[model samples]
Structures are given as C-alpha cells and as structure tokens.
Target: MCLNLKKGAIFVADSHFSEVNVEFLSFLEKLKKKEIETSQLFLMGDMFDFISGESRYFVKINQKLIDIINELSHNIEIIYLEGNHDYNLQKLFPKLKVYKRESQPIFAKYENKTIALAHGDIYTPKGYDIYCKIIRNSALLIFLNFIDFNYWLSKKIYNKLIKKSICSKMKDFDSFAKKRLSYYNSDIVVEGHFHQGKHYEEKNKLYVNIPSLCCNKKYTIFDGKFITTQL
Candidate 1:
C-alpha cells in the first residue's frame, strides 16, 4: 500500500522465498541484525513462495523468516502489500500493516508527487479477479488449511510452484505498462509482480517495477527517484 516517505524506504518484491531459498532467510537475518538499515521497509509482494495465515504448517515452515520480520517490525515501519503468492497474512503479521489486492493502489505523497503502490496484479481479467477473491477469503482459506495441513496438500502445491519458472522477460512491456498506468490517478505507480525490475516513464508519469530480492538479489530505494541496487 501507499505511505508518505519521510526517509528512504527499501522496497523488495517477488522474492518467492521458500524452504529451498536460503538466501531470503539470510536477507531477513541481515535486516534483523541491523546490517540493512531503513526507516521504512516496503514488502512489494511474493516475498514468500507460498504463505498463508490460515495454515499452521506453512507458518511453521517459514517461522524463522517470520520471526525475524516480527522482531524487526517492533522498530521499523514495515508495510506489506500482499502478492499473488503471499496473501492472507493479516493473522501472520499482525504488527505490520498488511494490504490486500482489493485495497490497493494505496495513495501516498512523495516529494509533491502522488504515488500509488500495489502488488501489480490489479486490473486483470474477470476470471482472475474472481479467483483472487475466492483464494483470499477467510472461510476458503480455513477450509484449505484443514485439508492442506492435515494431508500433504501443502507439499504438493509447493512442489508445483518450485518447478515453475518465475523469472522471464516481458516482451512489449512498455506498451503493457502504458495501458496499466492509464488506470491510475497518481503521478507515479510503484509495483512488483512481473519481476521485470525495470523503470518506465511516459507523459511525465513514472512506473516503477521494483526488483525481486530473489532474482539477482535486487532491491530498490527511493531517493527522490527510485534507485535499483543489488545486495
């Protein structure tokens, strides 16, 4: 979601962190150890490969990373915009400000410019929209949790996700972004989901695709303009 930037904020996205990705856990450890300093931490989404609040098994699976985040939240202003892969997190990270897909394009002021923040999966087809709603529902999540945690359903889902390729080059991305920006009322749109890690400017409006921390160890900092850097 949107937050006014009083100081530099670290924006991380599409990390797709899981049990296999020890790097993501290390990054959390660094943040917890004060190696990575920031007044604000923006989790742009998909930070977890698959995490839900309803499932105790999934919570235990990522407990180390979750604990680090929970500890850091005591001091840092952490904002989590739930991604496709990571939703239903309100129960998991109660201290952090969690934004769901429907509540996005959260608006904020950045140096006299209005900024909109989202997980970048908005304005999709009607079918996908419905799917998002169903999946994020509390009742549905509880039902899934019953089956997933009791059985080995979580393992099956995790296996499928791990096999899929998350990194890819989006052809004609400028055109795609141009169309997306037209739906926004802000001067700048910052989002992450496509894992493109690219910036685009058109008609004085800026669109930032924040880099994935899992992909090339990339992250972004806002210093007047968004700056992309590697860890």
Candidate 2:
C-alpha cells in the first residue's frame, strides 16, 4: 500500500524506551494530553530497548506507552516500522499499522515525491543479515519464550540494553550514505537505526536518517520537507 504522507506528520525513531530512559513516555503523555498534536505518527524503529510480542515480560514492562499508543491509534494514523530492538509487534498492536523488517522500505507518496521508508538495516553485511534473521525469526522467539524462566533472561537483556551507548557520528557519513542510497529507487529515502539524524542529497535524491529520539531528544515532522525538532 502506498501511504499518503500528510502535512504535519510526526516521525519518531529509536526512542529506546526503558525504565531508565523515560523521555519517550513523557512525549507520549504530551501527545495523549493534546499538548502536542499531529494527525499522523510514524514510529521509525527501536522505540523500545527490547520488545517482542511473544515475550510476556517485555510486554508487561512497556505496557504504559503501549497502551497510550493503542488508544491514540483510534483517533489518528500511526505506522510502526519494526527495528532490530523491537519486532513481531502485529499481535501486540492490533489497532495500529505494523510493518516488520522484511516488509520495510514501504512506499509513500508526498506531493510529487515517492518516499521509501525503512528501519535502515537493509543491505548490510552477510553476518549481520544472518543475525537479524535469527533474532527476528518467529520460531526462535517462540522457543525462547517457552524456555524463559520467571522472566530472568528477559530482564538480563533489558538491563544490558538500557546501559549501552547508542549515539555516535559516523566518519565520512556522506560517502557511506551515498553507497546505501544507491540501493534505493525513490525520490526520498527515510530510515532510522543509525542515530545520525542526517539529511543528504545526491543527484536529486534525498536521504533522511532520523535522529535517535533517546539520544537527541528529537523527533521529525514532515511538511514539504523533513524537520527535526527537540522535545
């Protein structure tokens, strides 16, 4: 399906929400209270540090933000593109539009532009590709869910992720991005996961790397162009 990119659409990427980082929660609260308003919301990816629909422990921990999002979905349009840290979300978010990693680079139309949206993990090295597939495999997730003991494994993973550093500036990002952009066939390519929040243009094609909301306290609004703003 080709999504129509509306004016004032809000896009949030890599919030990495956990007990330690509650910035995303507060942002959601503002949206819920109508302090911030938008007709469309795009959850680019990794909105949580570690979340899976099959994991009951993870669900229990992140229920507050989940609930608010589900409630908001009733009145507005929300598209959630699953990232490395969060996936298998179709069940957990029945009301919202959920797109898994494989189904990404979804096409959208904005004025005369054909935009490609993804979680930004595609066209990776072979080793990383295998790792992503293994991690996102439903069979593996089910097996882990079956073996989890009192949520011990889940807690360990969450604790580790909450403490890890995820922000950095890439060396020669322009060159790196150009290589990636070569793989896309769109007027604009938008993605999250790199945490760089860069905007680049080469040969008339625009590449937007949304900033990590957790690291930058920033989110994006799409009007005629992509706008990054602090919360």
Tens digit per residue, CA lDDT, model 1, 1-231: 346875688898988987555567777787887887888999998998988888677787888889889889999999999999899898889899999898997888877899899999998999999999888788987887777645488878888888887778889989978887998998999999988899889989999999877776888888887999777
* Distance from true location, Cα of 44 in model 1, Å: 0.7
In candidate 1 the C-alpha lDDT for residue 225 amounts to 79
Q: Estimate each model's TM-score.
A: 0.95, 0.97
Q: Which residue segments of model 1 deviate by more than 4 Å?
A: none
| Total backbone collisions for each predicted model | 0, 0
Error of 2 at 172 (Å): 1.5
Displacement of residue 17 (Cα, Å) in model 2 is 0.4
Q: Over the stretch 143-206, how does candidate 2's per-residue lDDT look in tens digits? A: 8988888988888888888789888899888997897789999999999999998898998999
